[model samples]
Structure formats: structure tokens, C-alpha cells
Target: MRSAKLESMIPAIDVRNLKKSYLPINRRAGGKTIALKGIDLTIKSGEFYGLLGPNGAGKTTTIGIITGLVRLDEGSVSVMGKDIISDYRFTRSKIGVSPQELTVDWFFTIERLLYFQAGYYGIRKEEVSDRIEQLLKKFGLYKKRNSKIRELSGGMKRRFQIVKALVHDPEILILDEPTAGIDVELRHMLWDYLRQLHKEGKTILLTTHYIDEAELLCERVGIINEGTIVVEGKPSELIQSLGKGSIEVYLSDCDPEKEALISGFSYVLEPYDGGSRLVFSVDEPEKSLSEIIKALSSNGCHIHEVKITKSSLEDVFISLTGRAIND
Candidate 1:
């Protein structure tokens, strides 16, 4: 039997039958584009969840709707059991969004921006200064607090965006491309802070082009494509489900006509190294390698080198989407 307290802990986010579409400005026939096709997803409380997809895959539109930026055509969204529309105030209060695009008030100083953001949540006047100072120092923006938003460097501005989002101390953090365009050092710094926040029981929803980021930080992921979620699972599990491993073979005299024959034995086959190298997935690497070599040798191709590539989150993503996230 489950305890009442535990059962009452509803998912941090619950989206049911979510749908949205856009029509042309002139309202021409056949000019409608569907952004979300009844997306159904859930993120448990205190969970680090990743929403992944290629460009124009409806990732941005979904985020906008969840953050109340885009109105939904149908369906309901809830945050911690509160309806997003009916209880807009309560649900909105729990979420802090860091949008993909860099948005900042060029007029306000970093300090003032944080202060103003905190004020939106009605933070007590006495505690606003403390909250702002704490976030600035945490994000390494204390010294740059007096700098205008336009005066700060790109990295500083990114960090300040995170700081502003955190100023209100929301329970759910929604980050879209949080580490995009930042240097590796700043990215590492942000990753460390995000990890700390997750450990402290904050629910995080991250959308990024970096596969490794999702693999490292997200406990679970949901991949969306063509305006619908195609797969959802732990990163490792998704990869393992595809196959045990992959084999890369370089042939001295490769036959393009034999490519389909090799693909017949595996789920994926791709040409590399100007068509001289062949990479394919396999359930049993040793057995598959032997068979591949035998087949290639019969085609008058000399094996130059062979290597096994371990399955990874990136592979799983590519397998599902048939392309990379940025592509």
C-alpha cells in the first residue's frame, strides 16, 4: 500500500493531450503548421528531465506553452497538481524559465535586473537584497553586479540570466539550451550549479543540443519529433535497446553494391571515410565482425582495420530521429 503523503506528491509536470498549431498571417488555405500533436508527458517531482529534439521539432513551442508564452489549442498542463490555466498564479509561481534566446533588459544593471525579477514574485523587500546577492555570488556575477546588461560579456549575460531565473527561488526550473554558445569553462560552471540544485530537490527540465549534457545530467529523457514524442527512457536504456554495440570496418577495396548485404545483418549501416569505411550496429560484435569480414573478403575487399564503437546516448538519439539534434 502506498502512503497518502507519497501518493499526494504529484508529478512536477503533467501535460495531457497538449496540442497547438499556427496559421499563416493571411489565413491562406493549407498554410497551417501543427506545432504539437497532442503531446502527453510527465516529469516527477525532484527529477532532472531532458526534452530533446532536432531544430523545428516543436521543442520550442512546447516549452513556450508550458511557460504560458503560447496558448494551447487543446489539452491541459499541470504543475505539482495545480492546473496551469485554472491555477495560473500558483503554477506559474513554481516555474522559473531560462529561454533559449538571450533576453535581457539592456537598460538595467545586473543587480537591478535580479532585484526586479525577485519583485515579480513579491519577495519581501527585506529579503530581496539577500536573495539577489546570494544568486550573484553563486553564479560568479557578484563583481559584475553593477555592470549594465549590454556591457557584460556573453558568458556573463548567460550566467546572469540563470541568476535572474533563480532569484524568485521557484521549485521547477525550465532551461532551454542553457549552455548554448558559452565557453567550456562557463558550461562546466553552470553544470556544477545545476547539479547542486538537483541534489537540493529542485525539479529541472532541460532542453539542449548537447547529447552529452543530457546523458550526464538528466535522469530520464523524452525525445520529440514531428510534433510528437517518439521515445522516452533513461539514456542508457534507450541506447541498450537499440543494440549491444557497433562495428566500424575500413576496407581497402570496398564494393558499394555489397552495402545492402551488410545492412541485412544489422539495424543500421552507414558509409564513412569517403565510402571506404563502413559502420554498422551489431548485437554480438565478435560474431558480427567475423561475418562482416568474411562477406567483404568474398567481394574482393581487403580488410584494412576494424574497431568496435560502444552504444551511446548520441547513437540512440540519432537512431530515433534519423538525424542529429542540430540537423
Candidate 2:
């Protein structure tokens, strides 16, 4: 069950009672905008951990606090056992962060920018060139070495940022929505590269609104909302916690009054039939599916298809919050 195959390693990241707040000019008289509310989390050595949340869920705030971009109002953060505040330089040297925003100079080419970033990290002059070339090729940016920042596409720019962050060879990497807004093929390529990185013993913390991506790449994930940690565990575990049973029923046709009859059924907590498809949520999947099929048949409803699927993380989130619509 171990996703990371490293041997005899120590935890690369740790956080305790992490908290942050922001003050706004138009805030309530004495209340501060809570960004992180007492988060206690950890990432074992070489682990692929994901932080999943919707926009405004404080994913950025947590990364900002850990990387020293924002000041912390309470609690502590550490990377590779170095205190982020007290041993600031040492802590930062062991961590790399690829921000969600695209930040670059229009005039600089990919090669020059990467060299500059490595120089800023105090990497030896003799060692920088080889490392830069290797990273560029690995991320498929070698041909674009001389291309200006503005000339590259969105996916290329994201790959460039990742290369720059990794130039210093940090033990832990924090990626904020690395594949956001990119094409399907580019996303797959990026995913392949990240999987390689994870296999090479580099711990990663990923935050993305793309639920399916998180489900694929993350061995375990932490979900947060409204400045609070709602759930933390492996993706499968959280989904299983919701329930063992779920069913989706597709119908060939339906009547206007059929909606009311299906809605009044005791087994149905959630039901939807947009003329052709009728999805159902039930605690006892097998029993409910049978009853639903019988009722539909008795009422002259023709079911075109019926299938059963376990509750996924998306279902868990929606079930917990009772959300009508979501990402």
C-alpha cells in the first residue's frame, strides 16, 4: 500500500496548529478574515499529498504561510525539520514552490531565466549549467531554451516555472494547480513528469480544483473549506466513508407525475431524471436498485440502463455539505 518506495528516509514536511488571518478595511468591527483555522497536517518523506478545495478555500494561504510569502498570526511550519520562521534560510533551501500565477519577465528566454533562478539560490556556478540542461530536457522544454517567456504557450510557461522551482533541488515541492487551464495532452504530459518526480523520492504537495486530477495523482488528500479542515485521508477512504452503496438508473422515458412518485420513495435521498437519465442515491444500494426498478416497471417506466457505482470523493463532499451544484 505504500505509494512512495523510498528506503530509510525521514519526513520531509511537518505542520502544527497552523493558523493565518487577514485584516480588511471593511471587515466587521473586531473580526479578522480567517484564512487558515488551526490546521494540523503532515507529509511523510517522499509522499504525494494533495490539498483539494474549491476557490477561496485557503489553499493559497496555507502554501503562502509555509513558504514565508505571508506572515503567520499563530502556530508553526517546518520543512525538512527546519523551522520556517526561525531557520528561514535553511527551511526555504529545502523547499520549492511553483505558484499558481504565471510570473515571468517577457524579455528573458527560458535558459537565462532558469540560470538566474539557480543563481539566486546560491547554486555553484560550475554545477548550474548541467542541471539546467537536464531539467529542460526532462520537462520537454529543451527546444524552447532560447524562446522568450511571452512567446511560450500557457502549458510551456507552467513547465518553465516548474523547472525554475526545481533548479535548486529541494526535497519538498509545492505545486499550486500546475495543470490548470492547459490542453488535455499537455495535462497528461505534465502528469507523467510529476509521477516521475514522485518516484524519484521528491515529496509533493498539490492544490487543485480539478477533482479528477487529484483523484489520480494523490495517494492521500486533505479537503478544507471555510478556513477549516473538513476531511483528511486517502481519496478512497473518504469516498468509502460516505457509504458502500450508490446506484444510477437511466430511463428510456418518464411522465411528469413520475417525478413525484420517485421523490416520495423512502430509499431516495437524491434523485434526478432529465428525461433520459434518472440518478439515485441510497444507503442500501442493492435493495434500493431493486425497488426502484420494480416501481418504475409497475408504473410503466422503461429503464434503458441501470448501473451501480461506489460513492467517490465528489459525492462525499457534496453529501457532507448538501451542495446543489459544484466544481
Candidate 3:
């Protein structure tokens, strides 16, 4: 530990050149399907961090390793200044994990599930009862306390999983797509609860496909692709680092000639007039719009509407990794 002060202190989660590989099938390949390749990251205490990547991009593998569900072939993980392997009990005790898989015991009622989870953390009987009540209310699962796991809706069950993970009030929280399949209202409600927890000084690491969620909730974000980090920084910082500000042009008519003109510029890439829209980007839109309009007019086309939008977390992810966040 360096210092307790917020300015200089140990991170809640630290991963150093972490690597995990699936064993190769005989006669198929020389090496394994490396799930992680030297992933190095540090998430400060009390920070809301996002882990983002496309499918099979190692997001879940990284989560499994940190939560002790999957063993890593190399590298180290630390939670709250304790090495995960050497201080396994203490490290595990300090962290809460809600995995993506739905594995609830069908027979366990909501209340019993949370109560048993609390007992696993050695919470006293009285305190366990008190905490379960509070968690149920916080997650909007209070009304379903007596309901069996199989009886709860998907959203309610998701909330129960979160409440179960938080039975111990762990200092760190890991949520893997906690809002997936949830309606907008429930998703926002869950976001509010997570925000409140973060305000109470809980470090959070979340993996989500929702770009807007990542942009709104995460202070810092790490984007991994092909088992390596392509970008890591404050969300705003990463967004501002994009080369071209995105521009979407809606037209009353199609014009390939004008679209080609815009695409010729090294800065205005991904230009396509497919399906009745000329969409592209410009490094300096304010200065280049006039030139673009001229080119369009020369091809007997006119812009019906043009909008310059700021880069989003999704944009930054694609710009860095060359793939959409959900891909």
C-alpha cells in the first residue's frame, strides 16, 4: 500500500500481464486458443471501470480469472493490495462477482439464497437478516422474497444475483452484463443502484454491450481486442482521441460520385452511399463541409441533412480495435 489518500494509493484491482489459454486439441494446432495475452490493467479504488470487447475477445475469461472460476496460465491479480493466489481468502472476501451465467438453484427462495450467501461470508445471523432485507429493497426484489428462483422474472432474477453477490458488502463489485435483456427502466434503475454503491466508495468493474451505459457510468474504460488492451483511459479522454469526428449525411437522393470524393480523403474514411445515405467523417468538418457540398452539387446531388456528432465509447472502440463493441 502506498498511501490511504485518494491521490496516491493502491488500486482495488490490479492485473499484471495476465494471460489465459485454452489447451489445444490434439492434431489441431501447435499452440492453444489464447484467451488472454498479456493483459495489464489497474482499476483505482472507488472508480467505475468498464471492460469492453467483442464476443470471444477475452472479457469473460478475464472475469473468470479474477473471480477464481477460471485458472490463468500466467500473470497476477490483486484485490485491495492482496495477491489473489497468496491471499486467496482475503482477496476473495473483498470482492463480489455476478457472473453472466444464470445458475440459480431452482428450489431456493430469494430470501434463502441471499441469507445463505451471507452465511458463506460468515455474517452473523442477526446481521444477515438485516442485510438481506436491505439488499432486497435496494434491488426491487423485496416483494419476491418468498418466490422461488424459477418463479422470478428474468429481470428480478438478475437483481437477486446482484443482491446475492453483495451479501457481504464487499469493497469491490464485478458485474458481467448485469443489464442484459433488462428493460430500459430496470436497466436505469440498476444503474442508479450501482451509482449509489460507487458513491459509497465501492470499486466497480463492469462488462456491458450497451455503449450508452459505458459512456454514462464508467469514469475510465479499458477496451480489449484479440486478448490485448487497445485503449485505456478516461471515457472522455478516449472519445476525444478519435482521429475523425463522425459525420452522418442524410440525402433526398443517392450520389456515388460525391461519396467517392469524400472517401478519397485519408481522414474521411468509411464513406459509403449505401441505401440512400452518404456517411463519412471529416477531420475538420467545419472547414470541409463547404467543399463537400460543392462536390455533391457537382454530381447533381444536394444534402438533405448533415449532422456532426461527437465520438462515443463505441466509436472509440471501433476506431481502436477495427470492430464494433458487440461484434
Scored by TM-score, the top model is 1
Residue-wise C-alpha lDDT for candidate 2, range 1-327, written one tens digit per residue: 253444324467777888888897776676788888888888888899998887777889999988999998888888777789999989898889899998969777889888888888888667899999999998888999999988888888999989988999998899998988889999999889889999998999999877778889998898878677788899877876664565766665556255655764543423355555555666656667777787787777777778887666777667655551144
TM-score for each predicted model, relative to the true structure: 0.81, 0.79, 0.80
Model 3 vs. true fold: TM: 0.80
Which digits, one per residue and each the tens of the lDDT, describe model 1 over residues 207-234? 9889889989999999898999999998
Give the candidates in order of lDDT, highest first: 1, 3, 2
The C-alpha local distance difference test score for the whole of candidate 3 amounts to: 0.81
Clashing pairs in 1: none
**TM-score, structure 2 vs. true:** 0.79
lDDT of 3 by residue, 1-327 (tens): 334584337889999999999987784667779889999989998899999888888989998888888898899998878888889889889889888887668677879877778888878778878878888987878988999988889888888888888999899999998898889988988899899999998999999888789889999989889999888888877776664565666654444544365555433323444435655565655666777667666666656678876667787788788888766
> Higher-lDDT candidate among 1 and 2?
1
Tell me which of candidates 2 and 3 scores higher on TM-score. Answer: 3
Off by over 4 Å in 3: 1-3, 6-8, 24-31, 246-306
